[model samples]
Target: MIQRFIELGEGYGDIFEICELARTNADRLEQAFIMYANHNDKQVASLAISLKPVGDSKFMPIYLCREGIPYNAEKPSQRLAIFEEALAQLNVVPNRFEIKHSSIFSENNLYYQYLIGILRLNHYIPPMH
Candidate 1:
């Protein structure tokens, strides 16, 4: 199966969209995640929404808000808090993972591929079929 990341923006704004998607497609929602990374000594996070494949379409789209929010572990932010609250309302706890910054990759697509590998390895998403 093919899995891909669809980048939104960052933080609560992205979370809002994710929440809406989850609420609308509650049946197909598989997992919600927050990808964290350190970029030039700054902590940031990306929101993700994973959906199950439909019919013959083997692609699983993981919607994301590319690294933008300050890591809550280092500093508290209202944006992060709002995202957490939204997830709570959806009854979907986020699966967090620390990862390398996208800036390190030559292309954004490559960065997404790297995240897909990590997610598969961690069993957050299914392996290729």
Candidate 2:
């Protein structure tokens, strides 16, 4: 199985697009997760939704709003609240994890690759097959 992260810009208006993707593909929704990273000394988060493999290609698309929103557990941001509300409607409870910031990598793609590896290592996503 192949899993890839489809970045839909930072967590601005793009967050709505991620939520829409989950709502539209409700049946294919595999997992919802929040990835928190410390970037530039600021705690930020990325909201992601993993979808089931498409057709027979085994390409699992995990849509995300990359690290742009502030991470505050004590007082969640409105955007995070919106995402949570959307997930609630779908009966999905997002799994949260703190990870190395994307700045560690030279390119965004590399950052995503690193995240995929971490997810696989933790069994959050399936291993290559």
Candidate 3:
């Protein structure tokens, strides 16, 4: 089984795309996740949707809106609000995790690898076969 993160840019206009994907692929949708990380002293979030492999493709695509939305307690960002609304409409609750910033790694790919490890360790995703 192969699992990969398909980044759809930050939570700008791409957030709508994420919502659309979830709605369109409802059957394949496995779990929705909200990952919080500190980036440059700012609290940001990455919204992700894990999809089960389609048919026998063995490719599990994890759609993501990388760290962009400000995770403010006083007032949430529009992007975050939209994500919440979409999940509510679909009756899907996302699993949230607060993690260290991606900047801890020298490269972006390493950051993703770290995230994959964390998810696997927590049983959010299956381990390697």
What TM-score would each prediction reach against the true structure? Answer: 0.89, 0.93, 0.94
lDDT of each: 0.83, 0.89, 0.88
lDDT per residue (tens digit) for residues 1-129 in model 1: 889877787756576787788778777889888778998878888778899988889989988877787785856677777767777887889998789998899999889889989999999999998
What value of lDDT does candidate 3 attain over all alpha carbons? 0.88
lDDT of 2 by residue, 1-129 (tens): 988888788655798999999999999999999989987778998899999986788899999888888988898988888899999999999999999988889998888889898889888889999
| Model number with the top lDDT | 2
| Model 2 / residue 6 / CA error / Å | 0.9
lDDT digits (tens) for residues 63-91 of candidate 3: 99988788986898899989889988989
Ranking of all predicted structures according to TM-score, beginning with the best and ending with the worst: 3, 2, 1
Clashing pairs in 1: 1-129
| C-alpha lDDT of residue 44 in model 2 | 94
Query: lDDT for model 2, on a 0 to 1 scale?
Result: 0.89
How displaced is residue 114 in candidate 2, in Å? 1.0
